[model samples]
Target: MIVRPRMHWLRMLFVWRGSVVPRILPRLGFFLALACLAVATGPHPFNLREGPLGLLGVALAIFLGFRNSTAYDRFWEARKLWGSLMIVSRSFMRQALTHPSPALSLEERREVTDLLRALAVSLNHQLRGTSVPLDALDSGVRERVVAAEHRPARVVLGLAEWVARLRHQGRLGEVLVTSFDDNLDRLSEVLGGCERIAGTPIPYVYSVMLHRTVYLYILLLPFALTGSLGWSTPLVSVFVAYTFIALDTVTAELEDPFGTEPNDLPLDAMTRAIERSVMDLAGEPLPPPLLPDKDFVLT
Candidate 1:
């Protein structure tokens, strides 16, 4: 994610690191060249008349706007789920560490805390389709989780088994068990949410339709404007192309919020935050927060 201070509107005009312009520059240049060709060729029988473009522009804008909104909604929802994951991970550790229970030893509490930390890292791995970073796992935790069918979900089930064992030993009363279970359920819910987003993409048909429409409009637009704008067609057409192009690119990046792209959710940073929170509760020194790049992009 591109983390930055709020820039003045004027400064934002020159901001490049966080903008979509870089990604779409190739397409923008292509359309700019097309605009120049249309102008140089002057009028032609096949030239698109500018008079009929207004209605089509409005309709296209509406479709693009809706598509962009849908993508942002998915991005925001994924962020929220990760946020909740952090909360629940900490809460579970807190309960295991501080709750009064003669039957639960310090070692048992530590084991549960380690599990919480491993779960946080594993779930992030699952979302990103990557293996758990070795540094994120404590000794032995990695090897055991490697064989699980779904590493993150299995860690959660491992948590459930721990609870069952504690309850069986009468170390946890029904009331105490309920609280821990509640937070475990929250963790499960968060994992399920992230999985849903990662697995179920916006329908391919909708994406293809919007993608083709944006390109077609931008490519054909220069033809319409060149007749009236003449030599200035490249300037006006490139500006128009940039708007449509930028929006389309931004939407595509955001649609998969778990990606490592500059604009996607900062899953690495968020996962580190969860690790730190769990460590604090485990009575370990918290690691430093992950910093963004020089350009203010974290992950």
Candidate 2:
């Protein structure tokens, strides 16, 4: 996501591109209009007392906090899994380059490296529900992996089979094969962890409940405060509404970290990093890192 440099507190307050303000502005405007109406009507027939509303706001904050925590947990765990994926990939590539006996030919070495590269790209696409980029795969590797149902798993299998072939040929000893297998297993775990996060989300009922309560609270807030706050009702109510609604919007974005949202994880950039790391180990000229956009969003 957003990768902007730190700004002064006052400048931070006015930062627009990465903030949730744009998404919730309409909702805040609606609250402002509703508050003005409550003031104009004098809270005549329906004055919601602040006592109950104050209690409700406190409870709402707690729930929002819980949900935000849960969403951030998912986002952080996904990032960690990708981190592990990168580490394991580098280790695997190092082994492929150094361990095999009768040393692998240029073609064989490229095959191994391409599979490593494809694993990251395929996993990135799989998580985001997008197609694998053709340019990322060699023609030969692409032919084999493209037909598979799970491209990442298929790429991993290719790696495993290569290791098996080495063992059968007496090129790789049992101990070396075991080391390769351990790293391969770690790669599989990374895949499984990413899948679990992508497949299972925070329960929808909680989201719906909080969404309704936040809006309804903002709706009734003006009526609750208009009697006392009078002319200041619109300003105060809209400001309050911004906090709850902005948190709600941000949690929604963070909950799906694989998404293309400005706040979501930068899967493309991460995949590129994995590629560069592997290429560097292979002694190839490394590709440039993916730069963030003008808005400082990486993907």
Candidate 3:
């Protein structure tokens, strides 16, 4: 989410801020020095320590590697889910535009387009935890759509109801009704997918264990390396801490793709894009694209 110039690796690192290490390392550094001091001033500072130290180092390496991989997977999965939403939303708009509805009145056609626009805005507000005011639309339409707790679903179901009404009134053929129904099903699937990602979370136990292990590893690292690395323990500790912290931060940001975080998928922009596309299909003037202000996009 912290966008930098393609060549600016150092800036990217700084922007990430090494979520875990910067927070835990100072305390660990103090404890590590205390441990080293205890051994250095003790009579048997060089007692058989190589075996445990070597084993711990290997274990920490493996654990950090696995944690980073898991975090990356979560991040990528969230991206793919949002990508799916984009595709499905576009397809729904296309179907609405292409399916012939010759018997629709001018007012009815306008209402359908407005409903789609409202759906996009409602979904954006729902995902971002923003309020969608009833005053945003005409009084009758606003009351009908805003009555439901799930605004997006209400908008979608309203579309389905409209299609059904048209069919019953002989305004649309059965085939056209079925086609719209298919599009509605796809929309529902997309809504369910987003809800799944939002509601589910990485296990708390995994997070707690990872935190404890990283802290313990950093604490023990200085003692393990002090004899060989000497006064350079702090420097090495910082590097190791950064590795774990960066992974943890990336994971936390990616876990909720719908959030307003700088790194999160730009759901607001996506919703607007959907609105623009739908409006364009309906022969309305397109809204301007949402542009990123600086290096970082909304996502």
User: Which candidate comes out best when scored by lDDT?
Assistant: 2
In model 1, which runs have C-alpha deviations exceeding 4 angstroms? Answer: none
Per-residue accuracy of model 3 over 1-299 as CA lDDT, tens digit each: 44434647676555533234555566646765655574465443555354686687687667757766765676677566656656665665666656645644567756777777777778767877888854645465677777879988998888888788777777677777787888788778767776776777777787788778777766666666666666665577656666666566666767766776667777667767777776776677787887665755664
Model 2 C-alpha lDDT per residue in residues 240-268, reported as the tens digit of each score: 99989999999999999999999999999
**Candidate 2 runs further than 4 Å off:** none
Better of 1 and 2 by TM-score: 2
lDDT of each: 0.83, 0.92, 0.68
The reply for model 3, stretches above 4 Å from the true place, is 2-5, 8-54, 57-61, 64-71, 103-105, 133-141, 295-299
The true-structure Cα RMSD of candidate 1 reads 1.6
- Report the lDDT tens digits of candidate 1 across residue range 1-299: 99999989999999998797788888888888899898888787894787667677788889889889999999999999988998888778777776747644767766676788778788878888887775655566666677786988888887888888888988788998999889888988988888899999889998898888878877888888877788888999899888877887888899999998899998888878887888787777887999998989998
Clashing pairs in 2: none
Instruction: Compute the lDDT of residue 29 as modeled in candidate 3.
Output: 66
TM-score of 2: 0.98
Instruction: Rank candidates, TM-score, best first.
Output: 2, 1, 3
